[model samples]
Target: MSDTPLLDQLESGPWPSFVKDLKRVAARKPAAKDLLKQLDRSYKDKITHWKHGGIVGVLGYGSGIIGRYSDLPDEFPGVEHFHTIRVNQPSGWFYTTQALRDLCDIWDRHGSSILNVHGSTGDMIFLGTTTDELEPTFAELTAKGWDLGGSGSAMRTPSCCVGKARCEYSCYDTMDFCYEMTQEFQFDMHRPSFPYKFKIKCSGCPNDCVAAVARADLSVIGVWKDDIRIDQAAVAAYHAGEIKPRGGGSPYAKLDVKADVTDLCPTACMSFDGKKLAIDNKNCNHCMHCISLMPQALRVGTDTGATLLLGSHAPILEGAQMSWVIVPFTEMEPPYDNIKELIANIHEWWSENGKNRERVGELMLRLGMRNFFKSVGLEPPSQTVRTPRANPFFFWHAEDFEAEAAGRKYIKI
Candidate 1:
């Protein structure tokens, strides 16, 4: 019963999130006004629950559909007013001042000024609007050549790490693939028919600059069949104290002679020459660090592309895991039809067999990767999938139904 407002009660703590946003919108948005009023009344009345206006959705778009909430029974305050839209971001994020201004002008016309630069999964999140405005907004966007992306239960937006355009470590073109997949998988992004969420990410190297290991369902990584690049001049620069390693997240803890980066070189491409270095293309791992560290002296070869790794979902499906090269490397040349075809194969497989709330990783685990491979009609590649458990459960094609003991024997071990 104190004089302090209910908003103050909710906003007093460290994660005073709603309060922070409300403060910014209070003067302009009537919806913010209603939100504060509802919170205050709920606090004073000690009410803890509210109901939603019956399920509402966008006409053509699916998933990213959100529910509407209300405090008053049978009354949806500004039912005509709530809207959410997603804006795609440019790869590498280099925005011109004019581009920024143009984007703002569009938002001011169709949405509230408040904008979340990027959503938790990394797409521009815009909030606030009316139901009546959706089609109009979408029409305007399409006419301006802008399009919507996935949200809600559909496939989320695809993301990529800085690649060939900026980073020296890039063995493949990440931006090209990201944009290509964005256009090719329009159905997945626009519709909602997945067991759970699907995410795609591309990285310039094994370093996983985009955190695809933790977030994405399918991860595409740049790799090469060749060896690592070594520049004696660059290694000398490091020794001479002229070059400094900046990114703290080096895969190798500390580059010392013992690290044997040269010996461990996948392509045996790197060798130290009397404190100098040399790169033999025949054996480079395409790990990119040595080249990234010495851009002037080292670089990836042309003919480089990416490997499509699959079934890397969040811990829910399996413990935190990285994707495995299910399809090995493919040509990432412009007009990425190969990548698109692969995506179609995966979606068809999932839609036919997956159950609700079951992620692709979980589906693979239950059906056995061998069955998944056979069903997808793709030839299995060596080292395609890695299992932490050395001896996992499996069923053999030769086993007979009468041999119950044999089936149970593998389980006993």
Candidate 2:
């Protein structure tokens, strides 16, 4: 592993990767070095499939990742198995030196040396672990005050911004909520009782560093119902290009950066009254478009929390859709019962009727919003599920209107 050319190739890049991290272990462990070489060679040979085992469980009450590899004998080597394990991370990512070293020590003892600190998805992914080592490794991890995260078809590990715990922009306690939700959905996570995977994401403010938009099956984003707090000093700094906005969304549109703010302001929220920034609450979408570009000047107010959105399906199911705010904005309570119940209801409904490969959003579409609401016992809100496929093309009103409209239409037949 010490002499592996791939390690040198990887080290030349911008930053370190899991492969590079594993090289440290590879230096001492011949098995790790052999594994890396095998992987490198496999890539060169265009090896596609990796095979492994089943019934893998993690330690404690609620922690572990379970996977089933594609059992195509002709396509894969007998030793190559495609499986991942979830190592629970420290809250707020505040890791002690001792704790960190202890974790690596245990991994060396039981599983593979490679560690994915965090890729786009939130879990601390451990690649290439055997099925037999699963339970014992989990036991050791939990014994050392760590557990597992979501893997397989279960609900994925929920993540949040480094909230009030670290970040100043945090309006709500995002960390507590993330941990609470993890505990709340333990059964749903450890047990594969759903049609497909579920994911949840929370952020301190609109500055969604976690990429909740594309990743989560359900997104809980923070917003303020009140006006943007204008810090004149901060705005001046931003206009001078000394500061940047904290939230996600259209950044250039805010702080009159586009130069069109003097004309038809996109949100009509910003108007320059002789070098002074004015915000109109009614037209604002709470997108933080302005706040982002001019961070010092525009800040989300104290009277703020989160909005729940749905319709996030992976590429396999369909393109991700933005779900409407069913429960518009709720207080971030300790237990988070309201949000938990809503999530549970959705899971229950999906589990009962969804086909093997069907996504929650697809199921909602197929069953109709009216029926979905009825079954869930949720009152239909203003935002109905957008029926992309079901539309006027296949819809007819009553008996005569369709025929009359068709007859009146200019047809060459």
Candidate 3:
């Protein structure tokens, strides 16, 4: 009889089976075998065989290792003391071949040899290891210039997209920013200072290749405050179907001027009269949609900056919510002092007032944006002119209108 009969049943369909891989690993590893047995038992009982609650980690570190154990240790001896480890990845996700080899050699020596690539918090996920192996593994990793990523109530490893390194649309040096932020907050990342976990992600532009807006607690998205740069000749080329829309990513053979470009502008700030493409730079919202579609014709403005947003969290205590803009724009330069000061101040406030396990986003929701921003010394930026209420909802304050004012006139919004 198959040892993992119920687990084997999962291989019936055409889809690739993790059960197959587990079985393969089980050939030489008792933990993998026990893991399969526990899974088969789970299939029969419809419940997990693992339970949490073990405070285990390397010396002098508060997080980065999560301990787990089997409820039936006698039935699954190999997985009795299995724990997960979060090895931090470098900025820009860069790794030399030797560095990767060093990681693999250490894991193979002291752990289950199971590994997962970059996690949401940007860590090399080492799946399973025993308590005995934890210290040795951490020691070896540190010797190789590697360290554990964050877990529990700590600052997570900061992540960023491949920025000025390769992508032309990148408005800032994301790699540099990520590296600096990591170095500056290594203490918080390892020491567990916050009431809950805090995460930061850098997106070179609103293309947001890292999805920072939807995921990170603090989303730093690149923006340009100046007018979008236009090349009339390139616009004519696209209009004459001499260029492909969206460059290599385009599925369309020709640029659909109305369908793809001007009409799709969030603020309707662009117009193409067949011969000429005109943009009302004053009304432009810097959406980046038109620029993405007509890359040859349009480019981001020269006045590069970043937009800071707060309160984004993945579905946990509360369901997933997108971040809201905090700083509409701020000029960025090397050793970003202004943003760093702002972050430090936020940490001071959040660490003081945030409840256990309450995300910063949730705090913003509970306290109301006004109260939260008031505590942090900020105000709501102007909202979009067209139906800002249902959309980003800038009509959040009664102060949005004066005490005795009859009506409001919005110019830039």
The model with the greatest TM-score is: 3
TM-scores of the models, in the given order?
0.76, 0.79, 0.89
Which structure is stronger by lDDT: 2 or 3? 3
lDDT of 1 by residue, 1-413 (tens): 53327677676787757766765675676656555566666777898435433445567877443434554623336323456677666665556787667666676676555567777556666665656656666676666666666775568788888798888667688987888888877788888778778889888777778877666888888876654444567666654545554333445433442144466666665667548676666555456656555455555665567777877765643466666668777777878876777777787888789988777777877887776787776777765747545767645544443355566533211
| Model 3: residue 216 alpha-carbon error in angstroms | 0.8
By lDDT, who's the top model here? 3
Off by over 4 Å in 1: 1-22, 33-55, 63-65, 68-81, 91-94, 247-274, 277-303, 315-319, 392-395, 399-413
Instruction: List, residue by residue over 251-341, the lDDT tens digit for candidate 2.
Output: 5523444363334456666776545778878777676666655555667887888877765666554566655455567788778888888
Error of 3 at 169 (Å): 1.0
Task: Output the TM-score of candidate 2.
Answer: 0.79
By TM-score, the candidates rank as 3, 2, 1
Candidate 3 on 60-173: residue-level lDDT in tens?
A: 998899898988899899999889999988877888898889898898888887788888888889988899999999999998888999988999989999899888788888
Model 3, position 270: C-alpha lDDT score: 85
Deviation in Å, model 1, residue 53 alpha carbon = 10
Model 2 Cα RMSD, 1 decimal: 7.1
